[model samples]
Target chain A: SQQGEEDPQALSIQEGENATMNCSYKTSINNLQWYRQNSGRGLVHLILIRSNEREKHSGRLRVTLDTSKKSSSLLITASRAADTASYFCATVGFMDMGRRALTFGSGTRLQVQP
Target chain B: DAGITQSPRHKVTETGTPVTLRCHQTENHRYMYWYRQDPGHGLRLIHYSYGVKDTDKGEVSDGYSVSRSKTEDFLLTLESATSSQTSVYFCATQAGGQGETQYFGPGTRLLVL
Candidate 1:
């Protein structure tokens, strides 16, 4: 079962624009991370924000987490054509049994035009 | 890149045959995970290991089994391959610490006919 759900199944934007993707999860999480995947390749970690932190920035990527709403968002500032890829959000949850695993969302496919 | 590599980048196997995919990491990360990607289903975890000999099943672990006999190696085996098992498999490793990031392997495209 996928605990995380990302809004906007697909997004198309022009270069130099900002692309924002949102994700929501069902359970309490220890941390949330965003990843980017190119065609036919594996995922690359973009940024990770802990449950206690509301926002974080890493170079061109910005991530925000809202524990109250069980949601998070990824913002790619000044996007470029090379940023065209599928973005996914993963949530790491801790259940009562102490078991933990990362649950990924359906993902948002972003296309950046030059 | 965390020095992770997956074997048999692409494979086509017949139904009922057993298939195994190998994930190797040189980073010596303590956490390793196996996931499958399919159309409309972003990515689903199959199994993960926190350390050597410590493995656990994920959401889609019915037809798959994983082994982690060594720190650098994690193997995922399909007991009986089926058409539904055709998908791209990815392996990820994470350093054991707070705010650790996961590094992923290229991926293995498997097709079961």
Candidate 2:
């Protein structure tokens, strides 16, 4: 079952512009994570924000999590052509019952035009 | 990058046949998970192993089974493959601590006809 739902299923942006993706989950989560997947490739970990943390940053990537709202967002600054890929938000809910499995969203597809 | 690799990156099988996918990790992570991805369903967890010989079912584990005989190897098996099982399968590993980052393998594309 999918716990998170990402908004703006698809987005097109010019190079150097910023891209933001939002994810809303239904249940309480231990933490939220963002992953990037290129065409015909595996997923790469971007950043993780714990329930207690509101914001996290790594290089050009920024992630914000709001436990109260049960939502999270991923923002990429100065997007490049190489940044064109699918972004997915995964939630590790508190009710995993020790399984700690990640439930992923449908994902947001971003296309950065050069 | 984490040293994770999945064997038989691509496989084609017939319905009612049994198939197994292998995931090998050199990092020796304590946790391993198997997930299947389809067009509309981003990714759905099939099974996961917390430690050697310790495994549990996920939300979509009805048609799948998993085994982790060693810390570095986890295998997912479909007892009787079906056309609906055709999809890309991914394996992930996570270290100790809850809600930690998980590293993914390249994935295996399976086709059941």
Candidate 3:
């Protein structure tokens, strides 16, 4: 069972357009985070949104968390070709047994066309 | 950068051979983790250590093992590599708390022939 599952496994957009990606999780979480990975490289932390935060913005990236729905969305405004990469959503679940490890979603491959 | 490094960024080994991948961190973080990434499975945890010599199995620890003998170094070994084990392995560390974000090292690409 996956803690976070991303929708639209792949996405494509124009450089100046906006791109939105969604992630849904199954369990109650302490926090949610987003990471970006360029092809064949390590993942870079993008944003972290706690369960108490309804929305967060880092640069042109916006993250929204809906604990009520166990879902979150990431939006990148005015997307650039440099933003092309695989984006992943990870969840740190509320500890039912004091064991909490970050679980990652498969991710969405975003491609920005120039 | 997190001061985390993974050695032998790429490895190609034959089946049934023993291979070890190393992760070294300079941040002195308490938690270190090993994960394998597959095309459709995302990043699945293989093992983790909470402190030196304190290790635990993860969601996908079938044929993998890990050891952390020092605060700065963690090792993952495949006792007998199988073709099924061919995948990208990533190492991560957290500062030890709930909801703390993790930093990842450049992954090691392992191919078991």
Candidate 4:
């Protein structure tokens, strides 16, 4: 079962517009990671924000994590058509259990039109 | 793309038949995982292996089983295929322990009819 739930099930935007996706989890986590899955492709790691860190950025991608609220958000500035994909947030809990390795969110489908 | 690869990228099988999917990796990572993806269910772990001859069940392990006879190969087996088991299966590997970044393979598309 998925540990995180993503909001805005689907989004459509122009190439230059910004895209934002939100994820909420139920328990504490060691870190929160974002991944992108292109159509008919495997998942690619994006950015990882530790529980101790409030915000982190990598190029056009920005991620913010709020442990108090148990939520995280990924923001992509100046989105491009290449950015069109399904975005998922995976939560890593404190347990070192391999079975509980990564609980991914339902994901948000973003379509960036050129 | 990681050093991981899943064999038989696409497969179509009949119900009640036994099917096996293979995940091979060149990285020699210690941890390997098997997950199935469906329309509403994002990704659910079916099983994982920490090392050779060492495997464990995941949340959705009811219909599946796994085996790791060697470090670089992990195999997932469906004792009896069903229509509901038709989904894209992904294989992932992490270098170290839990919480480490997982590298995913291209995935295998399985259709059970």
Candidate 5:
């Protein structure tokens, strides 16, 4: 079962603009991570934010996590054509045996047109 | 981009036949995972391993089995392939820490007819 769900199943933007996507999960998570996938290929890890952390930034990417609402959002500033891809949010939950696995959201397909 | 590789990037097999997908990593990551992606289902975990010979099931592990006999290799086996199991499979490795990231492979596309 998928524990996370991302809104705006698809998004289209122009190059040099900003793109934002949102994700929501059901259970308590230790961390939330964002990933990008190009077409039919595999996923690439973008950024990870811990539950205790509210916001983080790397380059033009910004991620905000709200533990109270069980949600997280990713913001891409100054988007480029190369940034066109499918973005997904994965939740890392705590298991009883100190183990953890990622539960991914449905993903948001973003198309950046130049 | 971790040093992870999945074998048989694309495969087409018949139903009731056994199929195995291999995931190899050169990063020596202690944790590895297998996941399947469908059209609208996103990605679901199939199995994962923490160490050699230690494996556990995931949410969609009913028709799949996994083995990790080495630190760099993890194998996912489908006892009997079915149409429902036709999807892209991805392998990932996780860095050990409180809030670490997972690196994914290029993924294997499997089609069961």
Candidate 6:
């Protein structure tokens, strides 16, 4: 079952704009990670924010995690046409019997118009 | 990506037929996972392996079975395929660690008629 829910199932914006997508999960998480998938391709890891971390940045990507709210958001600044893809939020939930696995959310499809 | 590969990138089979999908990784990551993606459902874990011959069931494991006989190969088999089993399957690997990054393979599209 999906543990996270991404807001705005789809988004479209012009190049040079910024795109922000939000994800909310129901259970306590050990960490949250974001991934991007190009059409017909495998997912690529973007960034990971630990439950104790409030924010992290990699290149033009920024991620924020609020454990208190059980939510996370991914921000892409200066979006480009090549950034068009689907974005997913996955959470590593609390361990059960010394094991943990990621629960993915329904992805947010972003379209960057050139 | 990340030295991960899924075989038979695309396959079509009739219902009730047995089908197996293979995931091979060169990195020898200690953790391997199988997931199925369907429209509106995102990705649902089918099974995972923590080591050779150490496997665990995921949320959607009722009709599927997984085998990990070697460090680099994990196989997912559907003993009797159903039309509802059609999906794009992905294999992911994570180095042994907590909250580590997971690398994904190019997914296989399966269509069960």
| TM-score of each model's chain B | 0.97, 0.96, 0.97, 0.95, 0.97, 0.97
Docking level of model 1: medium
lDDT of 5 at B33: 93
Give the TM-score of each candidate: 0.96, 0.97, 0.96, 0.96, 0.97, 0.98
* Candidate 3 lDDT by residue in tens digits, B15-93: 9999999999999888889989999878988999889999998899999999999999999999999999999999998
User: Deviation in angstroms for B50 in model 6?
Assistant: 0.3
Pitting candidate 1 against candidate 4, the one with the higher DockQ is 4
lDDT of each: 0.91, 0.92, 0.91, 0.91, 0.91, 0.93
Model 4 — TM-score against the truth?
0.96
Q: Which stretches in model 5 have alpha-carbon errors above 4 Å?
A: none
Instruction: Give a tens-digit lDDT track for model 4, residues B2-44.
Output: 8899998999999999999999999988889999899877888
lDDT per residue for candidate 2 within A48-78, as digits (tens), equals 8889999999999999999999999999999
DockQ of each: 0.70, 0.80, 0.70, 0.72, 0.81, 0.84
CAPRI-wise, candidate 3 is: medium
Screening candidate 4 with a backbone cut-off below 3 angstroms (N, C-alpha, C), the clashing residue pairs are none
Model 6, stretches more than 4 Å misplaced? none
The residue ranges of model 4 lying beyond 4 angstroms of the native Cα positions read A96-100, B97-99
Model 2: per-residue lDDT, tens digit, B5-46? 998999999999999999999997899999999987889999
**Order by DockQ, highest first:** 6, 5, 2, 4, 1, 3
User: Which CAPRI level is candidate 4?
Assistant: medium
Model 5: how large is the Cα RMSD against the reference? 1.3
The lowest-lDDT stretch of 10 consecutive residues in candidate 5 chain B is: B94-103
Per-residue lDDT over B1-113 for candidate 1, one digit per residue giving the tens place of the 0 to 100 score: 57999999999999999999999999988889899998778888899999999999888999999999999999999999999999999999987766367899999999999
Better of 2 and 3 by TM-score: 2
| Model 6 DockQ class | high
lDDT digits (tens) for residues A1-114 of candidate 5: 788899889999999999999999998888888999998788998998988999999999999999999999999999999999999999888652255788999999999999
> Per-model TM-score of chain A alone?
0.95, 0.97, 0.95, 0.95, 0.95, 0.96
Proportion of native contacts found in each model? 0.70, 0.84, 0.64, 0.66, 0.80, 0.80
lDDT of 6 by residue, A1-114 (tens): 789999889999999999999999999888899999999999999998988999999999999999989999999999999999999999988863245578999999999999
lDDT string, candidate 1, A1-114, tens digits: 888899899999999999999999999888898999999889998888888999999999989999999999999999999999999998888671233467889999999999
